[model samples]
Target: MFKNEELEINLGPQHPSTHGVLRVKLRLDGETIVKCTPIVGYLHRGVEKICENKTFFQGQVWTDRMDYVAAVSNNLGWAESVEKLFGIHVPRRAHYVRTMMTELNRISSHLLWLGTHALDIGAMTVFLYAFREREQILDCFESFCGARLTTTAFRIGGLREDIPPGFIKQVQAFQDRFLDCIDEYETLLTENRIWKRRTIGIAPINADECIAFGVTGPVLRAAGVKYDVRKAFPYAAYAEMNFEIPTRTEADTYARYLVRLEEFRQSHHIIQQCIDGLPEGNVMAKIPKVLKSEVNEIYHPIEAPKGELGYYLVGEKGGQNPYRFHVRGPSFVNLQALPQMTEGRLLADVIAAIGTLDVVLGEVDR
Candidate 1:
């Protein structure tokens, strides 16, 4: 249906709005976009190759660097993959700790997304306020893992250790204060006529188009596809917890925005369950002191802050390291639909559409 004559223009590699090093070549007809082809690889860090060179647990640090915004999820994913490969079962407390950390990271990620996405569409102040909340989340991560951004807290079988005394109390306190900040954020935009006008019905992508284009996570769910790896494929103890996988049929910027907002609430709910259901078990499972990579194959998939993050590992029996390792970065897949989603939408809506998609450079380019 996008039949406008092509007029190409470069859209980002350095632009702050893209939230990454993606260079999208936009084909526009006047002020309306006809097509968009996203060019990538600027931030390529060879994380997959790096994973192959390291031992199972050693490779986890690389995961932390991939999706920097949600290091906990990335760490959890790689660890889970190695665990699957070696048949290393995790403990109950370890599962709870992983869930708590990952959910906190999820909130941190969405906070950054909301801020940056809003800023891309002209709401500058939202960025600052969102970070204000993000700092608290980061504090929680730092308290537990010691590093706020690049945390290698999760190990092959489980966590490096147990959560420190008072950590749960601090997370609970942060959660208590966090709801008010969410309210503040919603009050700023949810009902604002300008926000709604700029977002609603702009850049609509239908459910089939989303699936066809390989969209996942909130973007796919925003199109009313309730396919979360967490619920459908229960890795960790997510099946034990209760939360909704927010979906919206509008499939536009506004719909995606609402979907993310609802997801934040759901993540909060999951965190509460994790805290309430904290069980007693060893944080780190007993395994071989060091892995002698016999991993012919390893597949670890987790509900990442962005979407589904799957780590693929391959190794020969008795090998010192993996033969190959690859990350199915959700940002890479989710972004494939950008061209289809932006078709016939205004030039301004392209940024809003991308913002709603919630991509990170480390994940997208890695």
Candidate 2:
């Protein structure tokens, strides 16, 4: 009689496909995954603890490093949370500009995901094509904030200044061609037989599983949950902007790809709205240089490119720094769904699962 044995192995603490220093311990029965456990904390920087020691005005910089790919989104979350804690009202123009920059960041973050996810699935041309548009968005980031990756773009109450000269024109130039760029990405992969074969029924988790696991972002949306913080909780200028929450019922790798691609179009639409309907007003609000807080706690949530990125803060009376701080990073929470997606599937599908989750380990380990 032949005996079937299970073999266990580590997928990565160093493998490029794991995305960022993530290690998945997998038990395999032949080529199929029997069990999967993701081990994190490799890149821990004590971000929450460190932010508690920094004053509100000084702590926004650390947010830039948490989700380095979507630093502007992180900045928005941090700024809004602190603003909530202090009850500061940001200017209308600042809200509009912040909305535009954040949507651009959404496109940039998604582009990085599309390129790297495609590369993980063996599509090399799509990687290059995705990064081509991503570079232009990064250029926009640099032109606005003077940094591309760790852009601490927003202040506590508002912006430090208005959009730089010709910024509208720069964004419009990208807007004019971005829809076609999304179509270009679709042309290469949407109908490709290999892409459909690799992604179409692989690594599926239905809406119930996603909700039970607290999954959000494209992963949850792919499962047909239309719960976007932008639409549900509405922050920044998102409440005023027009956009759609893209969802798919498949809850598989290919479905997630289609949803994110549609999101690209929605984000492009939001940016155009901001450019056209941007309000004329002061960018910064009248807040004291030194802000002292009352004993208060606030939790603020935003729809980051990944999912619901939330910041929870506690303030002490007359304190310069937060008494306690916690981050509900989408990557960390969404990563919980990995085993649900990967177990009972082929080991090769694990790569597609991780890629589709779109986790940035910086936030996971922060």
Candidate 3:
């Protein structure tokens, strides 16, 4: 009688390809992943618990840290959630600015994903090329806010201030030139034999499975779902902006790559519209000197760069701080599908699967 034995191996918590302290325990049958278990929490900072201790205004800072790469989007989501709870109406001009910033942050976040994902798949040139464009976006961000990475640029009612004199021109210049940058990246990877072979058919999950797993953002869209929070539930001038939600039926790693690439174009379009039709008015709205909410509890979700980033706020009437605060981070939810995607695939394909998900550990563990 012959017997087969499965081999168990740990893939991270320190491995570079696992991307930031993510440990995956893999049961391998000779390089074929028979079973996979993702272990997170290495980056946990108790962001939700910390928010309960801080005033609503101060809690905005921690949101930036959750998805540190896409800080502007985090700021917008946090501010809008508080605004909804307080019934504070942001000025029209402020909404436009917020939309523009959020879109720019989206592009920046995607650029980082592209670079790092390509690097993981052995396309070194694409990494440098992607970062070249990302740097310009970060420069624009630093010009608007003092910080490039963790820019807590939004306030509970509106923005911290108006756009600087040359900020619009700077953004416009980048917007005009950015499409060519995307083309350059595609030239390097979209049709490359190795790139296609590595990504095209790896880790496919159907739209039904994605929904069942509570997935959102590009992963869900790549699986042929047309759900986008911005279009379905608009906020922060997204209703006024015209853009298409890119979707693919392939439901594979390559499809996700294509969807995100098209998203770059759509984000550019939204920003251009904001610039062309930007209304002139107060950037800040009138609110009480001290922040307090009559609403006992409320939940608000925004189309963050990663996915639907929702916040649940609980507090009593006239409370200075939230009694309880919880954040539904997209990365945290999205990470759940990792094991499903990686199981039964070749061990080498694990890196490709993880890269395609575009997860940030900070958001996952927070």
Candidate 4:
């Protein structure tokens, strides 16, 4: 007599590759995955609830803790949303500086994703090369803001101060040599036989499914959706920046890799445009010393590293703290597609799927 049985296993709430306290309950028929269910909240910190209780000025700090790797981007969203709430007009120079720093933050976030995602798939050389560039970006962040990782770099209406003296020259020096660095990443992993074998045609999700799942960013772009918040909904200085949204129809792990590499080029282009076209004016905007709001609600979205990071706020009359607050974190939304990407695929491909999504659990569980 012969018999068949499906094995059910938990991938992790603490494994290195799950990328942050994420556990997937997987049912496997031999080595093929029958189903995958991602379990989150092991790292939940009630960030939204905390923000509702704090003054608007103090709430931005908590945004830094969510998606800590892309904290500058988080800062941008929080500050901009608050500005929107109070009808604040940010200075043109401040917008340019914000744009430049946010683009730099995007590059830094992608470099980390490249390094760790590659490392997860056994491409060690690419990991080292990617981190080298990431370190330089972090150094730039440290110079601009006192802290490197959790940088509360922006205020409500504008930046806290003007860009530090010599900042332009420092960024220029990095910009001059950075294209070559991107080429180096390509040489190591773009055509490598092992890298291709691990990534190509693996962990694919179609464009229709991506949209249905509310997935955005490179993952959705790889499916040929061509939707980007920066392009679709202009924010900060993106209205003036000239760049293209990179897209591919393959919708596999390999396609996402290519899309992000192209994004690296575009982000570099935006930074250059900022450095060359930076206007001279006040970096801070004029607003009331104490921010108070009438009954109003707003939802502001920006293109963060992973995807569309949106902040939703409800203001009360003369309220110093938000009446209600919520965050539509990309990681939380994108994680919904995991089961669709992994079910009926080989067990090992689940790792590729999680990595391709490029989620940060801090934002996921926040």
TM-scores, each model vs. reference = 0.96, 0.99, 0.98, 0.99
Local error of candidate 4 at 98, Å?
Answer: 0.4
lDDT of each: 0.85, 0.94, 0.91, 0.94
Evaluate residue 293 in candidate 2 and report its C-alpha lDDT on the 0 to 100 scale: 89
Q: For candidate 3, lDDT tens digit of each residue in 1-366?
A: 856889999999888887788998999998899999998999999999998888888999999999999999888988998888888999999999999999999999999899999899899999898888889989998989889999999898888789988999999999989989889988999999999999999988888889988999999999999999999989999999999999999999999999999999999999999999999989999988888767578888888878889999887778888888988889888888988898988998899988988889999998
List the lowest-lDDT window of 10 residues for candidate 2. Answer: 160-169
**Candidate 3 RMSD to the correct structure:** 1.3
Weakest 10 consecutive residues of candidate 3 by summed lDDT: 287-296
User: How much does candidate 4 score in TM-score?
Assistant: 0.99
Candidate 2: segments with Cα more than 4 A from true spot: 1-3
The residue pairs that clash in candidate 1, if any, are none
lDDT of 3 at 299: 89
lDDT of 1 by residue, 251-290 (tens): 8888888888888888888898999889987888899887
